[model samples]
Target: MTAARANTGIRRAPVQRRSRERVQRILDAASELIVEDGLTALSTRTIAERARVPVASLYQYFADKDEILLALVKRDTAEMDAAVDAAVGALSTVSVRTMVAATMRAFLTIYHQRPAFVVIWWRGRSNQVVYDFCRAHNKRIAADLFAFAQAMGMAQDGTVQGVVELAVEVGDRVFQLAFEHDLRGDELVIAEGIELVIGYLERHATPAGIAGVSVQGQDGPA
Candidate 1:
């Protein structure tokens, strides 16, 4: 190939990186705005202003408002997924109680770490795109937990629905407590929530189980 031809075929690395960063900036601004004022207040114009990019440029990256919101949901969920995956990996072997506590802690940490994102995610806005993505993403996360429960032989019915339900219970309550009540001051609330979940799981979990299954430390003894 001629030098010009070779150059044309090669990707311009910086351009791609810059494009991604710009898109991220827009998404970040949208998330922050929606969290502060709710989805009804989110608009491309507002996002552009907050991101300091032209409104037209926001469209260049996202086709419309729905796309932007969907992107924000996916971004927040991906971060939570990564953290949960890391915590799960660390448990190489664990008891039902420990697994339950760890799962609850990982999830609570995700929201606690980004309370705004959690608020936006659960805001139940009227955007169908955001609604659908959140539904699917939640199923995927639950599926992962289900698979883990099965692999560890903790699911009595060979189905993870029970563990998944318990985890969601812990998550929903904690989310409410954190955002709706100002329970952030009451660290015991987080611990107690974990205990409630661990109690349910332990009643059903078999002891011929993985390592670290037994509860320990401040969060356990369930």
Candidate 2:
């Protein structure tokens, strides 16, 4: 009877810990593989081997390679969305120049956050699922940029239609460049791009004064 007193509260078995570890291992291996070989290089068997797990176990956690890729893309997209949201929040009570700078910082932040994925995105041969998602994401950003420019009174191309189209193009290119190339920490490069865009917007908005965001190269007389 005294020996029967030994007891303990409920506790998760070690199997649960091992299962979680396996899942994490799979994700880590997949991420490394992706960085080394790009998005097109992923496969369930390959990931299983890299993760040192049974191939069947990989399927236990993920339905397929596409599912894993989808998860990664979703994480990256969420990060970009959050970055832009924060940038816009900072501009809620700031000047246009400040907002522009914040926007540039946000773009660069997202660009450099996942260099490998960005490289894959720039390679231009990703799966259609990823490509379609990217197109939709860019469309949203372009619309936001257009609205922001108009709200700031800095986007006028003699008509709303013209400015809207130009804004969309400019917004797309700005982000595309930020992620497609090595421009991180290069303030001059980033500033020059921002200045070029601002100059275009200013020229269209007001024909009288020099309304561009002044930069080192473009400040000199024409």
Candidate 3:
């Protein structure tokens, strides 16, 4: 990695760090362009211009704009997954309510933290690759939640997997709604979403007879 282009503030790169830094610049440039002018503003030319990389160079890494959007989606979701996993993994006393709220909070935090993701995910979700990745993200979260449920002996029924999957589907839409009208996300909608997911889970709660199943959490309360 050499230095950023003086005025444009874009770093220019291919050694190992060089490749990594160039990728970051591309991602960052795409992010800025998207946020500044919506998806319509995104093009390899624009991204390279903003990133200070040549159009030819941008092609070497990403074949098209959709690929760049997908990259941003993947990059942001990885962080979101980490936050949700840590929240669920750290739940010392997991219940449907606590677990749901903690999960919602952690998941929502990502929207606030990554403006680029919030924009790309909502805007680019219709793209085939991004849509597929989004589905995978939902399943991954559901799987993580189900793993915790399994440790709690709530995994007795095959229905548990289905129920958790449903919760994820519902949560994804509700959260999207929360961000729909406002980029910052409407607080009222977020709270309602938390309550809605918890209530939905509570209705399908595994019988208390299975409550004694011991499970140790990662580090903190969810």
lDDT of 3 by residue, 1-222 (tens): 111222112223235888888888999999888877888767889999999999998877776787777778877888887887787666656677777887889978888877777777765566666677788778877877877666565544555677889999998888888887677898898899889887787766676413423346343322
Which lDDT tens digits does candidate 1 get at residues 1-222? 233322222122226777778887887788788667876777889999999999877767665666666666666677777777667666645676656666667766777666556655555546555655666666666666666666556666654564676566555565556555441424676678777766766665656443344222212111
Give me the overall lDDT of model 2.
0.58
Q: Cα miss at 180, model 3 (Å)?
A: 0.8
Steric clashes per prediction:
5, 0, 0
Q: Top model by lDDT, which number?
A: 3
Per-residue lDDT for 10-108 in model 2, tens only? 111125888878876876687778777766667889999999999987777676666566555666667777876676564424333454566657767
Tell me the whole-model lDDT of each prediction, alpha carbons only.
0.62, 0.58, 0.74
RMSD, one per candidate, in order:
8.8, 12.9, 6.9
TM-score of predicted structure 2? 0.63
lDDT of 2 at 124: 47
Model 2 residue 198 CA deviation (Å) reads: 2.6
Instruction: Tell me each candidate's TM-score.
Output: 0.75, 0.63, 0.84
Clashing pairs in 2: none
In angstroms, the error of model 3 at 136 is 1.8
Stretch of 10 with least lDDT, candidate 1:
213-222
Question: Model 3, stretches more than 4 Å misplaced?
Answer: 1-15, 155-158, 207-222
Off by over 4 Å in 2: 1-28, 51-53, 60-63, 92-96, 148-189, 203-222
